[model samples]
Target chain A: MKISHAICLSAALATAPGLAFAQDFEAALKARQGQFRIMALNLGVLGGMAKGEVAYDAALAELAAENLETISELHQAPLWPEGSDNMAIDGTRALPSIWDDRADFLAKWDAFGKAAEQLEEVADEGQSALGPAVGAVGKACGACHDAHRQPSS
Target chain B: MTGGQRLSSDDLSAAAGDGDAAAAEQVFWAAGCASCHAAPEAEGDALLTLAGGQRFPSDFGTFVAPNISTDQQVGIGGWSFEDFATALRNGVSPQGRHYYPAFPYPSYAHMTDADIADLWAFMRTLPADQTPSAGHELSFPFSIRRSVAVWKWMNLDDEFVLGAADTESLARGRYLVEALSHCAECHTPRNAFGGLVKGRWMGGAPNPSGKGSIPNITPGALDWSATDIAYYLGTGFTPDYDSAGGHMARVVQNLARLPDGDRQAIAAYLKALPPVAPLDGGG
Candidate 1:
């Protein structure tokens, strides 16, 4: 009976609404941030090449663009479960509007994906083509950020 | 000039003639009309439509951007050049009522008659939206329209904050930052009366919307090279590859449309500024 009581106590703790949700979303938030860091790293490489800050290499540009395209296509739904917004969670800049305006958010995600695909297709062609492609991707990033993310103080 | 004063009849006659639309297009972009007048979240060509329902919340009240589109019935399309000039430079409406400073005419008040006329001409060319203007929501005393004249009397001036520009680029940058872009409107801190604290020129301020603080662009605070500043202005990308977010993204969209040299000029001007620390740092 003591062992059964201990088991029930553990189960109750695990199912507690506030504690459980916070623990679950902490991991999701970390993963989401990690994914964005990776994207930024690859985007930096492509951006450097386009800006001529780094020598243009057809192979390197292709690799960076492909990485971005792959990441953009990932199914990120699980990472953005409800109640994980900045209003409910600290240290995250994802505003509550992302959940309130889910349709618009998803559309922006799709637009970013399309822009990444276009960037990948033309990245290896030449630096001239890469310039505009990178700009389009940058604009797509800004569009969503303007609507969904909080500004850095 | 007193509040509610219209342009003189001579000035009105001068502005009545056809303005140089080509030149005005530059003024349109420089003045950043679309940043507030365009529909919120608008992108690309849609930004040119001055439908104006964006709401700005402040300590006093929520100020709604009114429709400045060329719609004859709902917008300023039917207003004479004198009316438009007065509104832009004098902070008075066509109805002889004083306008709130949220419209940023305090900066535009320094605009030359030629630039104002040109801006009017360029505005006339844009597509008109049928949307009606929205009234501002304000608290008492502040809600009283007549109270603005007192605020105007205390704060309004056409003086340039910086001394004479030694170089042509510096001159251009001063015009853009001071009169056209009105960068200080956000970057400079304000007193309890909402007047800009001229002593702390480019020092950062509490974001009037109460979200975050606007950064200090003085040389002491922003250490980015001129090229970095210009590049960031054009592409919205920082040196670290982090993109500009929030309202600055819209600012980038407008600046990108300008000639490359204009961005460089702005960079040069910023670099030449005396460094002023942010107020929170005990400035």
Candidate 2:
């Protein structure tokens, strides 16, 4: 009885990591997509205000800007693990190029973060300056998407 | 006005070369002449020197821009206005040889005689460089200039590729975009023979630079409003505060040179385009 209990415990310990790793991968994928969706939603609000499609409200703009700035600051590097690319997983548009060119990807991400910070800083500048600030942020996002993210319909 | 006959190509060329510099300058930027004709790294006043040695990479191969500066030997300086008109409207070199479509003359074919003359006049003012342009590096079947004749036969038409614009603003936008800027050359999809796939106009396609795909600007793909589009053209930023980069960064610089109204017009036109779902990745 003592030998059987020891064997069972050892086997459970041996196989546990593999099962946990699979779950971790799925969670990472969900986190990655979730982050992008949040970013897009925040961007859309800011975009509408910038284009005058939606009336400029300082409070709303600041909120959107804050959201974007926070998202940009998030530690997203872990979300893009090796097998998270579209080639490795379904429902993903992250190209393998992101992994292949990790340094460039990080640089672009840094640029985006800087742009987001700029947006956050200028959010209170009212309608006049916000348009251009928002544009800067959009361009930074586009720069990363152009090189790293695969386009989806 | 002799016998009410149209002015000869020589007469038009001479008159145009002496025409209003300011108006011609507007056409110069509107037509994006400096983007290709200017030296690759040229900036400031050097952009006015159309020495022409830019390399455009495509699926077929790399194409080197030719000298259009007023150098008598190596450039079009010595050519008559008719020569210039022929090159723009027909994609034929002054020597009667077929020019590669890389010059964007297919769209230029729809340009008015007045705009052509104005543009030709402006080209004559540029400082000429004596250097001969570099050769194109294309695959066997593509390397032959005569082969372009066949391609032109199938693709080249004098009529507007898209339908006529309904409103006056739309018309202006269409003229600037379709004829002068030729945005579709990069934005639209291409067929197996490297011809523009008309149905997918402005749908965005793979980057010929082999980096990634271009974004779809049609309403279906891009959600930016007219103001946003104009802001982007003038400032190189998306409505969401992303700045334009890559080749488009250069294009935005050129567009920024235009007047505010012109950029607005372009934005209006983009907003008016029919929505098209992106067929593949990369917008």
Measured over all alpha carbons after superposition, the RMSD of each candidate to the real structure, in angstroms, is: 4.9, 8.8
DockQ of predicted model 2: 0.14
TM-scores for every predicted model: 0.89, 0.67
For TM-score, the strongest prediction is 1
**Ten residues in sequence with the least summed lDDT for candidate 1 chain B:** B9-18
In model 2, which regions exceed 4 Å deviation?
A1-153, B1-19
Candidate 2 CAPRI level: incorrect
lDDT, candidate 2, A1-153, per-residue tens: 657755664676597643222334778888877886787788777777776778888888899889988988888778988767776545567788889988988888888799889999988778877877766666666657656665443
Residue-by-residue lDDT tens digits, candidate 1, A1-153: 657755664676677655233455878899988888887899889878876788999999999999999999889788898878876655589988889999999899899899999999999998888877887887888888899999988
